[model samples]
Target: MCDRMPLLGMFPSQKRSPPLTIMNLTKLHPFLLLGSFCLASLATCDTAKANDVVGPLVGAVESTSANFLYRVGESEQPLRLSVLLDGDVVQAVDSIGRQEDDFVAKFSISNLRPDTRYHYQITNTKTGETLIEADEQHAFRTANPARHGNRVSVGFVSCVDIEPNGIWKEMQGLDLDTVCLMGDTPYIDSTDLKKVRTRHREFLQMPDLAELAANTPVVGTWDDHDFGLNNGNGHNLMEGKVDTRRGFVNYRAHSQFGNGKEGVYHRVDLGMIEVFFLDPRYFSQTEPSPVDPTQPTCFGAEQWEWLLTGLRESKAPFKVLAFGAIWEDKKNFETDDMFTYWYERDALLDVVKNENIGGVVLLGGDIHVARHLIHPQRVGYDLHDFVISPGHKRTITELDVFHPSLEWSLVEGWQFLTLTADGTQAEPTLTAEFRQPDGVVNRQVKLPLASLTAVDSSKPDSGLRAHWSFDGDLKNQSVLGDRVDAVAVNDALVVTDGGVSGGALKLDRSREQFARVPRSFLDDNSNHHTVSLWFKPTSLPAHGTSERHFLLESTAEGTESAKSAWHLSLGMRSSEDASKVNLQLFTHTLQPATEIGAAPAAKAQGGFDALVDREALLGRWNHVVLAFDSSSLTLTLNDKQIAKHPLPVPGPASEFGGLIIGGHRVGAGRNFDGWIDEVSIWQGEMPAETK
Candidate 1:
């Protein structure tokens, strides 16, 4: 219902209040006032009370298994707990004593069946009084197994300053197996351990949140607001320079932080997906010298090593790296993010690239908005980071600035994300859906597992018409046996190291170089064909130049004015807009000369042009596929369709010249300065297997 409400309505235009302080509470509407009142009243209860149970039974779930860790509030009387599966009491405990000051009781239940649902209840054993009756049964489902080919859905959100009553209702109805609170779950922002604990109790006392937590397993880490101050890091100063790191670990369910460190960083493995809960606030030092390897880093040495080891060791089909803040550097904001420690961040990505680790995705929170960003050409693939925040709080309108790497962003209403991993096919697929409080899906994207994996050209497929691996030679290794030797135009076109495959042909910008074949492999006018290749641009055209850098082209032998038969070129629209380059595919024929001396012009040219907007990072290999059928032409980048356009007319069938690589013509100015490898031409639409 608040989807249409103005973003400013969520946060009044006034001076901010400190965390745990209720100066802004009186400004909230009646509904929020009632909710806050109930939470405060429950959280303020005395811990030594005999029958009064504060912060009743709460469960922290395992990442990828059917295990649960249950925690409860202070209770003097001995308590009895029971867990039921399919209406049968499968596990039970009695006379469990509460811990020290908080008198909280902790229990761990393990070895349950995967994907199975269970109900739990608690009672006082001394007086046979049911503190939590079976009627209010809390139900939860275990994580799904990877081998079962089932879909595992996990929901995530952050920045729940003031509980939105409807948000939890929406989450409860989603029936997610696991819910990850990325950060700012409760705005404690206090160095006092007692105050922090009380704030967590207040958060748990919310009716909707409590109901959702009871029925669904919850996992989380903390951000600045919950870790003591706004934008606070490991060096944050409280009373007497005391950091709130201890308070964060004490109140949360995380049993371990890295190797004796107090930070709350951990990893959870759910059947096919592994989620890495990162702590960037705690253990992070201020920006150090970029070149100083011994300087303090964002993730200390131990945690960083653990993360690398886990990533290298994980065999899961997907890895979700969850953070409490934005991953990339935002131009407008002066905040603590991965950008501040670019060296360490790049080093982490280098491990993935060098180790050839696949199926990695980033998740973030604390921006108070939801958006999808792509770190262009990180390692071998384009790394995607999804940021979701302000679970039920007000969204920020001014934060909606245009980011070149941003794919989709929402600055208005509150939203949550549901990522579902499906391992039913040959390759696992992950689908992320962002939905509103009313259960309406705002955006959805399905990413294939192959996107994160290395380019494996070893697979055999029957649909492959032509494949130029370019390992050591320009031989076509397709079933058709259409082999063509490379005719190098200049010395600059030579085999070089650093390829997705083996050796790739390198083209220099300062020199004129290209390779051509003797026969026309793509001369067929069937209107169903695919051309796929790997390319890495060394440099973009100068700012005010309409220079056309041809990666591949085919033309008939004629005079200098003769039109190109067909070409795939990277060029700017005009001199004024040279920054916006376009990768265009032109298909047509040269008009027949009226007389022997007359020059030939273009007959009928109609193809597609896709803007090389984001994924075109310099010095990184990029996979591109230009596929067309009888109806439309689709341009795929890194295994995802980036652009598609319907053909206005059927492609013209002309006697084409040989295939040209790295230049427009043999002696033309349109020369490419990059590396090209793994060139393939298919007679029909490119199959998923080929990609």
Candidate 2:
């Protein structure tokens, strides 16, 4: 048996009256007709019945707000809605039926606290009588921001169809503060306003769905199907498209359908994160071209300007931009996807880069798959894109192809994503989890927060030279003229725990694991220089061990007896006290032997050793600096000068052959074990103390 009330005026009465044709009723105002129908129904039935009122589904949930829309499925007399928050009457609104919509009643509530959970119930009253009431209390939570020193989790999904068993149950299990419906929320491909409204009513009436909707706030945007047709765009002229847009506006609270305008683009701030919901379907141009400047567009000029301005002005730690179609140009059959609109997409990216907007993550759906992408070669920092789809519909099987920036991809699955932000530290952290339909987390990735925050790279005297943070890749992040490629030896060196963020490289002691760069980049040995790095040793060579473990060495290729221009190593301070380990800095200047009277004097070496305290170099990450001035060489540990030695012979040191990390350039000995990060070489003097 259908749970829906018949819309064709099939009220039970003692005597049958002539049927009122809907066409004839068009002459009367919709509200008048609605009122007349209600009065006639009431005259034929008992007004004391409690089953006449249908629903009070919750929608348009914001970080600190909520709105409820309900309808009197059969009631004729005016009804009053009483909303209770935590057992206290917070609001009571009498139904102004047909004034807003023919049969719907809307109650908007706001000014609530963020991250707070509230339980609520709605009751329908008429003439001092309670006719309908909520079966049970429902709960909802406000969006939590990371700036409040709290962690926030948000779940997102797309492409769901009205079904007996929808994924709403699974979504509720995620315990998310807010749920984003990325589009295709309902499979209502119709042009009739009545049909669209009916589909929405049927879908929301599902038992589990009703419970979830009433308790959890839902924010959504629409795609083609929900907009009245498949591949619907700005050119859609179907009779129902306008009504579909109207229904969306009436249903969702956070949506920004411009005052008397048509687009559903809006922004919501969830504490430390700001989410921008875009209208990719309504105002989109027909068949946008990437190469032509005069062609159509995805987000028209107005929306594009609005989006860029919002992003620029937002102070949130994380910014999420969401839309209905895939952001990348997969070159599939869908011409409306972001790829075909590359010009607009690239323009947005340019603004993000040029304006120094950080924490901007792109979210999208409609592909019926889940994937993560990294566009590493973008204008500024790399852009991370995440896609989750098939919120409840059947998945489609497709082959996944390899792309340079494709981190992970999968097909034929019903899944959603949870993005959690941790803002407890100076640099906030965000973690994204891809979960299965059963609420099991399938894959997770933690992004370095510093990358999400834009930095002014144009500053001079930032003291950044050859910096290698070793964050996922080996490319130099500095602009000091030299860009060197680092190669991992034996593939044994992998990124491991222990840098400031993503982690550092772990050089296994058992294997001949090390990394190396070219000598040409660091050939400026003639100037005052400073080299600093963070390293943690698993174990220091016991006191008298003859082997010298080199953490970094810039030297000319030669046998064991050869000298290096500069090196930081752990070795015995002479064979006498071989049982004690010392962090040593070696700087040498070689001069050809000159013999006026004799044949040729042996090559003379001039240098000094600045030894660091051995105890500070083991177990924990220690910041060591080897700085050189014209007259002296200094070794600092954790910003405090520990050792200083006057240069025995220092005019201008000669250039070394190559730079080797974790070991010597030419030998397997002097291998370093453990973690190393933030290796930098400066061509000027370094201060004894740094923040």
Candidate 3:
């Protein structure tokens, strides 16, 4: 079956009538012609009934859920409803009474899981025995949890209309936690209930969306078309703000948008990450870009204040500030399609800079194209900006290059970002190698935290360290088998063996293993302190189960016994070859334990690898440092700070006991087999890297 409804041409009737020929029109009496038309109308109605007429896509949200407004057809009949989960029928309702032209029915599904998928459909109850005969399944996912980690992937889209294949395929592969629809999901250009129903129904049939809804979590807000007439502003709706409010009401009822207040903006946590969804239409004052300060506002007074406060108070490591408008630094007024409202943008930017906040990312979609921008200046707070726009439905034209700080622009093609984070550092590496749907190749750029901080330094005191640090094996200054460049060249502290190369660092494997160890190991004197390190192995295996390496302390001796002065050493797995990270900071009997970390690939340069493999790590070098304050621990890698958290500092009890680097493993009680150097420990925090 094609699974599509036949469109009613020029005029719609309950029944199909034979096309009238010239002879029939000329010879037929008026009465006879009228009778034939009446018969045809009846037949058309019968066929519609037999085919299971499906119309109206109502969405309602209320106290008990049934109270939500519904987008229903103006028909005097009850509907058969079937709710599904991933194309499987879960619940069905039948034998409902016919509703008046304006009436709506109600049902509630409680006990729904947050961030999960589901499907549903409705049919004419009077004509079919099944609750919903051949009703196509529409999919949906719940909202995210409130608190999560530092990294998250979210999808945004707008300007959606009836199309050949749907956006769902592209959506599913992204593996996102949430989907933000920035308007035009349905292209309803009229206030007429029928037009809205038709558009909604067609959208429900989109398989891509149906599948997506059944799987990923979804959050939607409206734009002009779905809410009102073309280019709709709040004042233009039929019921004005009332209609706008109702549309939102219906949208919320259908989607997983949380409902304390009725509008689109809301915040939720996905794992360790938190996100704030913005609703610009309802509260917005400006229609087009050059925002009129004297005119009404967008985001209204209340929303503006709320957003400001929310951004300031957010505890998540990363924040995604999003909107519907285009955010191009340089505008093309001739196209009349660029972000507006500079005053508002500046206000938001001001809040971020002044707050001394980190990990804030901006997102938006509207141009029907994907774009990425890295602001050399953080607009307000000497901060750098990383912004991306991945639009939907439209085939991208060319790759656009933008270097605001460098002052040049290039059109490479459409692009996306693969961002990685580990509490301390987050890297957004652009891979232009991945083509857009239209098959255009773009360039990929990698941006590290170190670069961003130096380029966008807002603080006057540039002397303090960033936040984290790394101290690996005592080889050269590099963490991996790379050469030791100067602090000016590469800011991280250096650890190196006396000679060039020719030695292997092996782990003391025979011992008990704890997924995470505390920094108390360094507190030999029972005093509290934090410790961190970065390491590189001479050789690595892609797949294996045994063979471990050590760059720092181990607890293989025994769980409770701190027996031997020959306490512990660090560890690394040979299977994970290349480079690795070990960051542990713990308190003594008095305080708490906290850790922050990240590991980069060990790059081979010059005679580094060759010498390290055959001789002492001559060309190879690694950095190892232990910096602690009485209350906190800080770790860094390659000069880029990693994490700073409260923990028990190393004690003075170890003054009599020697500090060991490649000593015996903690639990295994075996010695580490690797070259060591540049071992340094400070009673105070290490000096901050240069901006």
Decoy 1 TM-score against native: 0.59
Tens digits of lDDT, candidate 2, 1-691? 1122223223222022222333433554565344323321111123422222334556656666666665555433466555455666665556544534535666667677666666554443544444333334355666664464877777788887765343566777766667787888877888788777767665555445555666676777888778887777776543456788877765564535643576788877777667798888776664443434455666766777788789888878888889778776443445557654555676687678778787888898887878897654243455788988777547655524333346787675567788888787666788888876555787898876677654464544234557778888665665433335566776645474557556687887668677776533432223366778888888666555566667777645322224544433322232344444566666554231122111111122333444444565667888878776645667777878877877555433443544667775453666777788888766465533532
Name the weakest run of 10 consecutive residues (lDDT summed) in model 2: 593-602
lDDT of 1: 0.63
Worst 10 residues of 3 by lDDT: 602-611
lDDT of 2 at 497: 50
Clashes per candidate, residues 3 or more apart or on different chains: 2, 9, 96
Better of 1 and 2 by TM-score: 1
The clash tally of candidate 1 reads 2
**RMSD for each model, in Å, please?**
17.4, 18.6, 20.5
**Best-fitting candidate, scored by TM-score:** 1
* TM-scores for all predictions: 0.59, 0.58, 0.45
For residues 608-686, write the lDDT of model 3, one tens digit per residue: 0111121222235555454445344444544545555443332222211223344332433323333433333322244
lDDT, residue 75, model 3: 44
Candidate 1 per-residue lDDT, tens place, 1-691, comes to 0111111234432123222234445555656544222331123212322122333434455532333333334544576667777678887766454454355554566666766767766666676654453433356666665533767778888888644445666877877767888888888777776777667666765545655665676777888888787777765442411335555544454445546545678877777787898888777663342333544467776677788889999878889989888776543444466655554675777688667898889998787788997653344555778988767557876665544346788874567898988888777799999887766888898888878775443344434555777777767776435334556666754474577788788888678777776555442233356889898888766656666777777655321224555533323232344445666666653232243112223344554666665335467888888776645667877777878876555432343545677777444577788888988876556766657
User: Which TM-score value belongs to model 3?
Assistant: 0.45
Q: Mark the regions of model 3 whose C-alpha exceeds 4 Å error after superposition.
A: 1-152, 188-194, 224-232, 235-263, 286-296, 329-339, 377-691
Q: C-alpha displacement of 37 in model 3, angstroms?
A: 30
